[model samples]
Target: MRLIEGTYGIAVLHADFPDRIVVARNGSPVVLGIGEKEMFVASDIAALVAHTRQIVTLDDGEMATLKADDFRTYTTEGTRTTAEPTTVEWEAASYDMGGHDTYMHKEIHEQAEAVDRVLRGRIDDRFSTVHLGGLNLDAREARRIRRVKILGCGTSYHAGMIGAQMIEELARIPADAEPASEFRYRNAVVDPDTLYIAVSQSGETYDVLAAVQELKRKGARVLGVVNVVGSAIAREADGGIYVHAGPEVCVVSTKCFTNTTVAFALLALHLGRTRDLSVRDGRRIIEGLRRLPGQIAEIMEQEEEIKKLALEYAEARSMLFIGRVRGYPVAREASLKLKEVSYIHAEAYPASELKHGPLALIEPALPTVAIVPDDDLLEKNRAAMEEIKARSGRIVAVAHREQEKADHTVVVPKNEDELDPILLGIPLQLLAYHTALALGRDIDKPRNLAKSVTVE
Candidate 1:
């Protein structure tokens, strides 16, 4: 296991010696759990928490030997390592369905509470700022940050895109997001003045972890925005925000995605406060953050309506999702959720780009989902919907007001424009769930996709 060249985790059961089990990991995670008269090993802690919270995490180059009553940890180089077991705080029932039919459905509803958990004890009302205790960077280091580069993959990448926009708008920093999968292969430039942030739901994503290592080796400062306490990326990064979304058993992300965006909002708020952001404006954002939990629950109230829309769209051959600016990332994530859970073909495009290419696909048979936040982009989005309606395409808009041109509308409660993306996303989760249900697809475990991509 020590000489393994790539990301791998293996467990071997000796046929002759049934009592002994050997497990090793290179780039992947391995957790050994201790229980009364039993032992367990899994790639994720969520699986082990149900039986035993006392567990030991194996590092990249570590291997372990397990027995019914005891376990031993060591390096593959024939050196012994101390295997200390620590008790995780989560309960066994965290993984349960809690009366929901599927984990996706449960997580969708959990967003309100999950978001509140992420916001708890983090806001500074007196200073009108956000206080992230885990972020090791102080005001001095933060003031030196000239740019922001957020790296992640899939859904995490989308969240980073939103974070970048917030930082650029609020803190006046040059910010952008890059897919971590391609970051290492391209030999990315590491700028000392640029604050690098790695985002991950599992904190065990292999691509993000590798990118962090490469950045550190080049003498760049990096932080992490991650879930799962003590996971690989969480352990490796200099400092970051712990998005407390709790146990998400669903393969498709819902609560974590929302929590991560809120986490970014906090980071952006903190950075902004250190710079030119005023106390008044910071209080506005802070108030907006407080309103999210109630607003999310309000959106969840529309589940039956969204389910109807899902059933209608589920019969389509394909779907188109569109938004402008901040809403663009929302469109992309919504498209991803729909495709992932419902197995439907979906494409997201910036509203401005429709006339350039995607406009050709508009027709009556195809449905369009538009994110039309009532911000500065309202008129532009309305114009795009007019364009789609001109082509006889049926439209469903997620917006603050009912769209005149849209055949159907998913009305969302408005917040600060920077915070609109958080609320606009909740209904789409329900859409994906009911659509998958209508199609009889497996909602929790989508085929060919793992909850965490540990292997590159």
Candidate 2:
């Protein structure tokens, strides 16, 4: 017998013998499936759903030995235990790889269901509360949280930005977002009273992992908002809520981004209801949360229109994206997606900063994608749109309401003020995907990028 231990979670499997093998999990996820005279194991549930849904989810500090006929469970301390197998009801069609033309398009369309999946079984209807068991913070502790600091990289960082906003608006918590890569370099102050959240789709992103490790080393509590189960960050963090976005096959993120933002909403609702947020307000947010999946579907129906619109701007030499507050992160993420899949040169800036520098670049030759959420910033976003129009720049507006100034308008379904960003992001995703398709660029494997960034 070998003892495998680490500061974070670890999954080890011994396959030296054919008939029997040892599997153990610390912080990461390991699911076992029982069949007739055969058993299967994997870190991701998606990989096993096709074969069997009768799964036993191994908790932290648990081990299992699989033989030809049966499996036995034990604790890390070597005590024999019993783990019941649960039959899960999941659609096998969701995991079918070859159904769509490209993984990017397939994952893009999966957002509605992906967002719905993350919200499943989480909301309490009677109390209008959200329960996130992984948060490990009770109402009393939650009420006392001094602040929230979120960390992530690339797409995850954009999601974290939205998360920071949700926490501030819904939970009334002081919150901010920083890039995990930069956070690790600065030796940032680690406060025990503040909740630190590390966001990563893979949960194995090196920068996010390093940031979590450093925060843990400093005795600061850390939580993970991650997609992949049992990933390094998921194991290392004290506790966390999984995004449960399933497998994101596209190098450029689509479903994961939307789902992560929804996860933040759930977390925010959990924190908000725990504090001073009234049940009336909580129910409003809860209803808004429930409306997201349908709203995403409504936005998706504009695919043909978005495809035609993409063709109109596919020839642009460069592009600009602008928004304010909640919309800024959506623009940033949209710009990244455009650059990644379409290989277009794109820049994103807060709408208020247009005159600061980016506004000068607006001209007939360049295009700007503007996010116009129907919030207090609506007037400011309109002013920015007029500014871009003054420079003869072609404008493509994503808004809850029609914008007369926009050269083209993609109207998205409206939600609560705080949830508008989540809805607005979907249209931009379709824009990016369709633009890449129009340009004949490799949608799945864009020029030099990997799905997960494991290195610095």
Candidate 3:
């Protein structure tokens, strides 16, 4: 226990151990301590309720003066703070069935609307001009950016990978997606003219923050594409685009990934237009963006089929995901979601590279998820699917149109090949979610993982 006296002779008595108290700069106190293994208390009941149904939140300015069989509390400065039992009636239904059976299902259904919201009011119908309020760069500055560096972690990093392909192809700028952790540790070349875009859902990923700060130190212009309104990254970046996906309570991200990718597409297209991109091409992309939401909703209605597939594959010991070009990133994210939520051993590979290796792991019992959007590489991917099939591999193909090459087809709604990742991504996310549910794993708070990795 310690007593601290402040500037106004405001004496504060703190009794809990340092680790048990979640202290903020604003002097908010969050008590996280255990009376017994079966008894726990915290500022937020959700953190402890899983361990013990009985819980309490310490009031502001209160000092937990007594620690025994019963609870006692007092004010920080010689006054008494009242203690009360707050009746928090938490309904699981709040997170369940917003419009679907599971949170993941609801989240998948929300993607189309989410994409529309991200694109709303940001594009001009003519597609000849672009306006990004936070991007202080004018046409000249935007045109001068010859290279782009995207930094993020997990699903966001995969989105960055897709962004790189889009930016390079549409905007005609060379782009590379680097994992923030690896980017920070390496000796990277950055300059004032370089446009560094940091992608994160929480806006407070430690490695991303550190990498952006390092880039700024080298005088590179930093832009952040994040979901949270007032996150550390959002506040720190020179320019930022909000995903506006709302509070994603689930640890395995679904809506946020689609939102981020769509937002990046808008940004890339905007930059492309500003840099003298062909007017026809720009209009085509804008039209595709406008149509993405409806396509997403169409795909969401296939939940029952996806769930059934999940149940059928629930016993699979190992899974492989394959994709090429933009699909590679989707494959990576799909593999990550499966591993994180379902505890399934899943790995992603570029379809072409499977011939060199990974093909050896293919068997009738193993499941292979191929992200085969109807793109230029569709034929090659089909060829790869043939190899998996020859090896007796169970194929769960995520494609726009059903190809008879796979054992089970998860049909993604039709979209421009460049935009297929946004639609194709949903089914895989749902597959992982349903599989996790079948395995009876925690859907929101996965084991040993925090919603935001705020600390290094």
Best by TM-score: 1
lDDT of 1 by residue, 222-296 (tens): 899988888888878998889989989999999999999999999999999999999999999999999999999
- Each prediction's Cα lDDT score? 0.92, 0.86, 0.76
lDDT of 2 by residue, 1-456 (tens): 344445333435556776776787754556787877888887666677777877776765678888768999998789999888877555467666667889899898888888889999999999998889988877888888999999999999999999999999999999999999999999798887899999998776778888998899999989999886656687688888998787887789989999999999989888988888899989999999999999989988999999999999988878999999999999999999999999989999999999998877888999999999988889999999999999899899999889999999999998999888998989888889989998999998988897667567
Write the residue-wise lDDT of candidate 3 on 323-400 in tens digits: 998889999999999998899999999999998988988888888999888878889999999999898888989987
Q: Candidate 1, after superposition: displacement of residue 210 in Å? A: 1.5
Ranking by TM-score: 1, 2, 3
Off by over 4 Å in 1: 15-20, 36-38
Which 10-residue span in candidate 1 carries the lowest summed lDDT?
1-10
TM-score between model 1 and native: 0.97
The regions of model 2 sitting more than 4 angstroms off are 1-93
Decide which is better by TM-score, 2 or 3. Answer: 2
Best by lDDT: 1
Q: Give me the overall lDDT of model 3.
A: 0.76
